[model samples]
Target: MTASAEPTPDDVVSAAKALHALTAIPDHSPRWSNTAEPTQWTATHTIEHISDALLFYSGQVARRADAKLPVLRDGRDAPVSEHLDNVLSSAHVLAALLRDLAEERAFHPSGSADAPGWAGMAVTEILVHGTDAARALGVGLILPENVCARTVSRVFPWIDLTLARPPELLLAITGRFSIDGVHSDPDWWWQSAPLVEWDGLPRRRDVKPGWT
Candidate 1:
């Protein structure tokens, strides 16, 4: 994913659509069963992590307007096909919820962190961590160029586009990997609070140093 244009909700959906194809890949393959390279989590565990994170974000948006979002998990311990199904389903649900919340100007907070630009957060996970899972399976997983570019712009404004490709940059920004003269920094973070002024929404008292 190296496109330069900003991403839209449509891009998020298309990325998820791309992820759905993983279900068809044979789970019995050694790659699928092996531990994810460059990371401790297995391919199945990484997919499960993605699914659960999306589920937690969805809860933040769909739960009561004034309620503090609870940390949630999907611990089914199911087979590969079931995990794939869970990932696809969770991604679709999160995409739709993000679109709706952004459109309606709804309040969505994860703990004390508010995510007005929810689409960027969702797309970032799909591309960066999705790559983690795909690579572990010994499969190629290139995100749509435009989607990747948009995520980089929205979430990692400090990075120069010329420094590296968008997907690689995104991973580095999230502290997932390092690149030449572009290693992950200790203070990396995304603009999760309202990027624009949205009056009457609950916001954090102050900006935190850590990444969301």
Candidate 2:
């Protein structure tokens, strides 16, 4: 099934509310380590990243039926508190937007040559990044079974699992690890490989990259 048959605006709002509740819990773990340069985002950093991303996408939804939103910059150098605040504020904006758009027009991330919507992108973000943030907090995220299945089906073909990496890891990289094997892969090698390099691994070309 296509994204048009997926969740509605009210559904997105409900999902966002559930995610907000998940992020509200206290995370006592040491902030994420910036070991991975460039995207040196730790667990908390990932949470902030997702929050920021949601805001960016949601803003586009609000500005116009087709507004090109700005990409997120590396905020690693920013003060931790400031970053955290930005994340929280962004998340709030996202949640509010979702609520406001209940059952409105459907968003399509893969925009027409001109404007793109955030529907599919939002679901992928909430499921994957939401799981990442929960993992950092030592909590387990129980996503809706249908959502998981749909996301997996949509993201599965886009990934190259045969590139010296576990199918699960590849799925995670492409945001499809909703079923089993999400955390089963001890080493996340797919994350280390260049996206282009994995083109020869497996899967068909019709499969689109879930995230850019």
Query: Which number leads on lDDT?
Result: 1
Best by TM-score: 1
> Can you tell me which runs of candidate 1 are displaced by over 4 Å?
1-6, 64-68, 103-116, 175-178, 196-212
lDDT of 2 by residue, 118-196 (tens): 3334555565665665555555666554443333333342443333233234335544454343432322222111223
Give the number of colliding residue pairs in candidate 2: 1
- Mind giving the per-residue lDDT tens digits that candidate 1 earns over 1-212? 34455556666666666676566567676667667655577777777776766776677776624544566565556777787677678777876776666444333332222333566777776776677778777677766766777777655555666777777777777666677756575444455544453333322324352122
Q: Whole-model lDDT for model 2 versus the true structure?
A: 0.45
Q: Locate the minimum summed-lDDT window of 10 residues in model 1.
A: 203-212
| Per-model TM against the reference | 0.75, 0.50
User: What is the lDDT, from 0 to 100, of the residue 174 in candidate 1?
Assistant: 66
